[model samples]
Target: MHASITAAGQAGPRLPPVRNLRATTTQAPVSQTVVLEWEAPEPGLAMDHYVVYGAALSDFSPSQATLKVRVPWTTHLHSGLPADGRTWHYRVVGVDAAGRVSRFRGSTQVSVTTASRGLPRIPAGNLVATATSAQQPDYAAEFVLDGDPATFWHSQYDPRVPMPHALTVDMGEVRPVTALTYLPRQDGEHGGTVTAYAVALSTDGSTFTPATTGHWWALDTEGTFATWPATRARYVRLEVLAGYRGHASAAEIGLFEPPA
Candidate 1:
């Protein structure tokens, strides 16, 4: 039969060569100081260091025996960690150079929690405005004190003096603030020229009523800085008139829950 088909095509049956490990995590429910990534295995064939393991998802396991880290490859950040909520399990191992170890099993499972305090106390006074010559570094102003004389209100700004620079907080009674958070201050000198801001809600703080008159918002940028969402009124006033060229700073001010 043609010499047995050329000896079975020169004895074709030597299949055994497949190696490509992987471990990735760029985004997920993860948020605690997360940053674990990897992908390396194809060059000179001498990998001899790289092992990272994690546990806390109700006892996750992969043979249960991995926590080594020793390679030329790097990308790790598992800092602090302890919001008390758990869901963490990562893996990456590839030891060569004689130790002979290759394992890359991380199907993705990161859900570490803690980071949502949003509105608790926030009600001290209101004095986050600096600009002695503002060179940079000064931002802290936030207030929502409802004493209901009519609905007290105050929003400060200092471009050297006058546009809207007032600060007050008494909160005697009116109770109805839904949201307010401001913390802008890196130094002074208009601190990066503050930039777009407004929040006015009164029930008796000082004869005021203009809860966002047309569409003005800029809490300083980072994540949810100015949110009235519905407007209930109790005395919440934060006004930086405009910033980001000079003078505008805040440190703390948050008030929430009061819409219906």
Candidate 2:
């Protein structure tokens, strides 16, 4: 017999697919740009677009999302949502290019609360190394948390480097964080930019998990951001999934308080 080890202790020391299918509550960020990514609702449906519905009532249906947007395929970057700082429930549905709505494969409902922070924003400081997990960039990662909007953490301009550059950030200690704002390089050029990405939270720097897998919107705007359910953790990892221009960069990162 071979005894093995893995990183599966964050979600209360158990994996997903609990017997209970009760609604789960998540906190949205104070920022309007929110990323909603989920496992395929149903496989082999040839889903064309994904629609999200958000409302104060948990009973709200996908048709009553009040604020609905069709993402490209299976994920969406719900931008411009009003930051009312209230609890909102979101439901996702798939629609084929032929205008056919597909059925969800399984439970696909999540409760998310908008950022409700009354105090000012807090700086997480420089805690991420330049190269982490498998990335070892020659440039220093300290440029990311230096609180300088003019500076940025840059990776070697290697378009050949397997993308989705993953950078694990440490918060010094465990703290309740609700939102993360990514300030793309405000410089005129756009070679080193992260267009799409996701984040995972961790209490220990080694073992990290996302409250729920979330999509970081494309770095179109100079100072775009994403807010999810507030979580207590000492580390956060940003995985650049797609749209890597030439390198991965960040002008500034803001870790918000419990959006209460």
- lDDT score at residue 193, model 1, on the 0-100 scale: 29
- lDDT of candidate 1 over 1-260, digit per residue (tens): 22222111133332112133333333312123546666544455655455555543324444323242344564566653322222345565545454444433333334443332333333444222222222122222221222111111222334354444433333445665555544333121223323565667667666866665222223322212455555545566655565444344443344544323
Q: Which stretches of candidate 2 lie over 4 Å from their true place?
A: 1-29, 32-120, 125-130, 133-139, 158-160, 212-219
lDDT of 2 by residue, 125-185 (tens): 4355444422234345676676655566666554446555776677778888766666665
- Lowest lDDT block of 10, candidate 2: 1-10
TM-score of 1: 0.24
Instruction: Please give me the total number of clashing residue pairs in predicted model 1.
Output: 48
Query: How much does candidate 2 score in TM-score?
Result: 0.50
**Among all windows of ten consecutive residues in candidate 1, which has the lowest summed lDDT?**
143-152
lDDT of candidate 1 at residue 100, scale 0 to 100: 44
Model 1 Cα displacement at 20 (Å)? Answer: 15
